[model samples]
Target chain A: MPTQPTDQGPLTSQFAGDADMLELLDMFVSELGARSEQMRDLLASRRMDDLRTVAHQLKGAAGGYGYPMLSQAAGVLESQLAAPVRDLGEVAHAVAELQSICDRAIRGHRPAA
Target chain B: MSQGTSTHVRIDAANLESTRPLVLAIDDSPDVVRLLQVRLKSEAVEFASASSGLEGIELARRLRPAVILLDIEMPGTDGFEILRMLKESPDTVQTPVIMLSGLSSAHDKVTAFDLGAADYVTKPFDIAELRVRVRAAIRTFTLFQMLAQRAQIDGLTGLWNRSHFDRRLVEEVSRHARHASPLALAMLDVDRFKHVNDSFGHPAGDAVLAGVGSLLRKIVRDSDVPCRYGGEEFALLMPDTTPEDAAAVCERVRQMLEQVTWPRHPEHNVTISIGIAGAAKATQLAPEAWVERADRNLYAAKSGGRNRVVWTSIESPLQLNRAG
Candidate 1:
């Protein structure tokens, strides 16, 4: 919570153009707020295991949803949490960056055909 | 070539080769499962997901899905272990399984392959690539199934051929033996089949044989395996059926045979003489001996009359009881 995450530019998913994924993308965007809340709660409770699971899930899901950057941020947070030499500070910062991307992700981003 | 067999062959082939293949995904993460459901949604295949290994395996066994998308890092039984178990089980052994994992390590890939995984897809995989891979797996699986069915199916009778009969007899008998389940075998001979060929011409004889095959297909239970033993001879293997129950089935077929009016040869009624032999428990007799007993009873039926059923238990006194 101490270090503020810098903006990482626009957050339109690369898969926005894909007709099959557009519906799923909408669902993912709708769920982002709740997902962010859950991650924050998990981090607050110091539930590193549950937090890593959430990150791992997001890492796998976001990329398919066309948000590769969000997926990458989650993957970084997951890796930090999995590391044996735990840096709680770096882990906290990674979580912030992932959440920051989630916040900036605009709903109904037009497909780049 | 019989008129009815081609349709039966087509039906059997269609059953084996599903038009819309079922694809199963076993992932621990709900998000991953949901993404897969959406991504793999296509007209050519049905998608089912299980958030745990146990449920996934159960679905795989029940559906016999053409292809499986298995995730490696599951909670209870990991994908590698699940793959091993699936490969070991006969029911799901032929199903193509693609391992999905976040770990891109060669060691993990090697492990998945060693455990009998058909393909490996790392996490955040390209959507188009996954779709192509799944289609490829389904094509491979359905083709394999069709080839296997063709090998075992008889061209004329629409029943399993002799080779399939030989293999299935051994397998079913052994299975029943292990389970101590009641098992029966009926050896059927088309009475005066040579006369039909000599009198009504070869085409009429072919029609008669096809009729018998059709009748067998209609009469036998779904669990029963009916096979064309050879020309004018057939065998039906009935699992979990006693001599009495098998005789009832034979009698029903006989009655149905009376109703089948030959296309060209209406005057000549095609009759089948069935000889049924069964054991209370399959463990009592060997498969060959059991078949021999059924054949003996069939011989008795042929001698007793042209269109009668003869049945005898393996443990019964040396007497062939004809049940008309």
Candidate 2:
């Protein structure tokens, strides 16, 4: 089982050594990365519908896994893409912000001894 | 796994219909149900009325409505119980349910929202706002379904595709190995496909490919899967088929191509060289190994002469006989 990042303070503190939680978190990070790439591609192709779809999925999965920050970013991104008039620049910034937040969360939540 | 747990879930956003969106209205008042039904009639939304929270839960389990509008102030089996049950049941877990209640206090709304109610609509809910929330829930569900479908299908051919084939191949290979069943694979290549493009045109080449696709579909059994492995090449996976049987099938397909006249060149005919490989003996070989064997044989046929059928097992024997 691969190790993964988790929520800080209390929610993830108890499960810091839990290998299963770590594995799940690792999978979550990987999924986030994949979704980020997908968002980039969709934006590049100017596929707003596909971008919204991918962002919505990322939002749901991130929320489900207790990554509220990641989920919120994805949600903002989804709403931007879902809107009738899409701001491509805003979408791009949101995607980059999401990637950064995911990166930080992944680094911050490493198993604390 | 739990009973009825779907290994894969498919959601189609394109098929999302705002019309007749199923809403389970859980409230003691018949007037509330009537009001919602009348207000949403033009939206083509359907309503399943539940007088009590228990009835609401039962109806939800049976009907699997797109959204549930529950009033929190019900007498027995209050909205909270139904909400808890809905969250517990995997079937209803993902379905968005909005809590409708006279308790308009901010705390009550916060609690309901925390309990997984998609949205909290107070007793004096605006009809337009409720409709908007319902549409959003349905839209979210549809998006999830479409994502699931996209995960399974090959974006290119719109056929079963390589990922699906990879998963199926593992199971099929396992079963064949266990039962000692013959599983044959044939690798097919269009004869001088590159030359065809060089001589005629790319559009002509595409036509030839389309023709080959149709021909393969016509020649193979419905159970057999023919995949466009890549450009100018196709692969046929015939489960429970012997190498010799597969060879015959390939030969028949090749003959069919020979008869079909190319439109670009009236005098020219298209042909395909096929290589067949199968596991006649019981072995725990990977599916890719079998495919590789067939691919090697395909190259052999291509080099030996195009427009021929070559079986991997026969190669060594033919060479031995020739040596003798």
| Candidate 2 Cα outliers beyond 4 Å, as residue runs | A1-113, B1-160, B313-324
- DockQ of each candidate, alpha-carbon based: 0.36, 0.01
Best by TM-score: 1
Who wins the lDDT comparison?
1
lDDT of each candidate versus the true structure: 0.82, 0.69
Candidate 1, B1-324: lDDT as tens digits: 111111110011224345578888888766676687777766467767777777778878877888999988765677889899899999999999999888899999999998888899998888788999998898899899999999899888899999999888898789788998988899999888999999989998888888888889987899999999999999999988988899889888877887788988888788889999887765657789878989988988888876888888776645656556
Q: Where does model 2 sit among the CAPRI classes? A: incorrect
The DockQ value obtained for model 1 is: 0.36
Residue B96 alpha-carbon offset, candidate 1, angstroms = 0.6
Q: What is the lDDT of residue B323 in candidate 1?
A: 51
Model 1, residue A56: C-alpha shift (Å): 1.4
What's the count of clashing pairs in each model shown? 0, 3
Q: What is the DockQ of the complex in model 2?
A: 0.01
**How close to the true structure is residue B187 of candidate 1, measured as C-alpha lDDT?**
94
What fraction of the correct interface contacts does each predicted structure contain?
0.56, 0.00
Residue range A1-113, candidate 2, lDDT tens digits: 23245334322322345443455555555555566666677788887766665665455445434566766787788777767887777878887777677666666565333
